[model samples]
Target chain A: AQTVTQSQPEMSVQEAETVTLSCTYDTSESDYYLFWYKQPPSRQMILVIRQEAYKQQNATENRFSVNFQKAAKSFSLKISDSQLGDAAMYFCAYRSAFRGGSEKLVFGKGTKLTVNP
Target chain B: EAGVAQSPRYKIIEKRQSVAFWCNPISGHATLYWYQQILGQGPKLLIQFQNNGVVDDSQLPKDRFSAERLKGVDSTLKIQPAKLEDSAVYLCASSLRAPSNTGELFFGEGSRLTVL
Candidate 1:
């Protein structure tokens, strides 16, 4: 079984600043995928960024990036030049590459991010 | 491309009542998923379908929950005699195919269920 953990319950960042959300996971599978998802008050889950376990280089998308440390089983999300729109609940997710037919994402408890103006 | 669509943005039902949620996956997507998002928690996988076929439903409460994806395009998730613990936002997502093939997922605005 794969379990994702987001230790921070809440975080706050000033507008135009940077913030990092921490996440860790436990998985015996060598091949897997890590993802960061954002959910606003609208309740829509949106993809932020993703990292492949095999890739040594981190994944970056616009202002969102991931620090994936495969050996430490850590995958953290960094948001630069944060804006008010970045205020949301961020969730760390895990999925197995070896999933036979049905592949589903396993998510961790979310970190509530507040952007201060 | 049109994103995944879900219906009944909000639903309030009494415990022991029945409720159903619908989802329309993105065109050409062969995989669909249903998830439950509790307050302040991440979404949890409830069931998955691959082209109208059941894929993984290990976490689904078979005794009270059931889902179907007929024709592999639209899907429905139902809960009979709903419990208070079942009160959560139900999210629907779709992907191209296998996880290794399609790394991204498109999600719909979840249907929020409140069992009183």
Candidate 2:
């Protein structure tokens, strides 16, 4: 079984600044996928960014990026130019690449991010 | 494309009561998922369906929770004799099949269930 861990329980960033949320996972599978999801007060989960374990390069989307260290089993999310809209509960999720059709995400406890004006 | 849709945005029930949640997946999406999200916690997968058939439901509490996707389009999750621990937000999501595909999941605004 794979387990994801988000050590940071709460984080705060000033507007227009940058912040990073840490995540680690335990999985024996060599091929897998890592994702960062954001859940706002609306209770809608939105994809922030994703990283493929095989890829050495990190993934970046707009102001969201991931620092993926496969050897360390670490995948962290970085938000640049943070805005008030970035305030939410962020979650780290893992999925097996081998289980192509039956893949299910395993998520970690979330990190609550607060954006200060 | 229209996103996944869920009904009964909020539901409140007492312990030992029964409650149900409905979900409609996006058009052309072959995979649908149901997740439970407790406050301050990440979403947990409760069930998965592929084209009206069950794919995985290992974490579901079969003794009290049941879910079905009929016609591979719409799904429903039901909990009989709910417990206080059952209080959580139920989220529905849909995606294209194949695990390698990293297509963004479309999620509905979740149904908030409160068991008194």
Candidate 3:
């Protein structure tokens, strides 16, 4: 079974600054996908960014990026130019890249991020 | 494009009562999922359907929980004799697993359930 872990339960960042949320996972599969999802107080879960384990280059989407270290089993999310809208609970998820069968996402507990203006 | 839609944004029921949640996935999406999000925890998948066929339901509490996707477009999750611990948010999501797509999932505003 694959499990994702988010060590930081809470994080704080100042507006216009940057913050990194740490996540790690345990999986036996060689190739998989990592994702970061954001859930605002409205309880809407939205995908932030995704990284393929086979890709050496990190994934970047606007102000959101991921530092995926396959060897270390670490996938961290970086939020740049933090804004008040970034205040939400962030979840790290893992999914298998294999075609067919089950492909449900395994998510970590979550990291509640607070942006102070 | 319209995102996934869920009904009964909020539901409150007493323990041992029954509750149900409805979900309408995005059009043309081949896969649909039902997730349970307990307070302070990330959403955990309860059941998955691939175009009206059950794909995975290992984590679902079969004795108390039931779900169905009759026509592969809409789904429903029902909990009978709900337990207080079942109080949480039910999230519905859909994904397209086409050759050109990356299997990205689009989620809906979850239906919050409170079992008193």
Best by lDDT: 3
Clashes of 3: 0
> Which is the winner by DockQ between candidate 2 and candidate 3?
3
Per-residue lDDT of B1-116 in model 2, one digit per residue for the tens?
78888999999999999999999988988989999998878889999998898989999999999999988899999999899999999999998887435745678999999999
| Global Cα lDDT for candidate 2 | 0.91
Model 2, residue pairs in steric clash: none
What residue pairs are clashing in model 1?
none
Q: Write candidate 1's Cα lDDT for B1-116 as tens digits.
A: 78889999999999999999999998999989999998888888999888999888988999999999998899999999899999999999999886436577789999999999
**Residue pairs clashing, model 3:** none
Lowest lDDT 10-residue stretch of candidate 1 chain A? A95-104
Candidate 3 lDDT, A1-117, residue by residue in tens: 999999999999999999999999999999888999999997789999988888999999999988888899999999999999999999999998887747789999999999999
Q: Candidate 2, which segments miss by more than 4 Å at Cα?
A: A99-101
lDDT score of residue B51 within candidate 1: 93
lDDT of 2 by residue, A44-80 (tens): 7888998888889999999999899999999999999
In candidate 1, which residue ranges exceed 4 Å CA deviation? A99-102
lDDT for A93 in candidate 2 is 92
Sort order, DockQ high to low? 3, 1, 2
Candidate 3 docking DockQ: 0.77
Q: What CAPRI-style quality would you assign to candidate 3?
A: medium
Q: For candidate 3, give the lDDT of residue B49.
A: 95
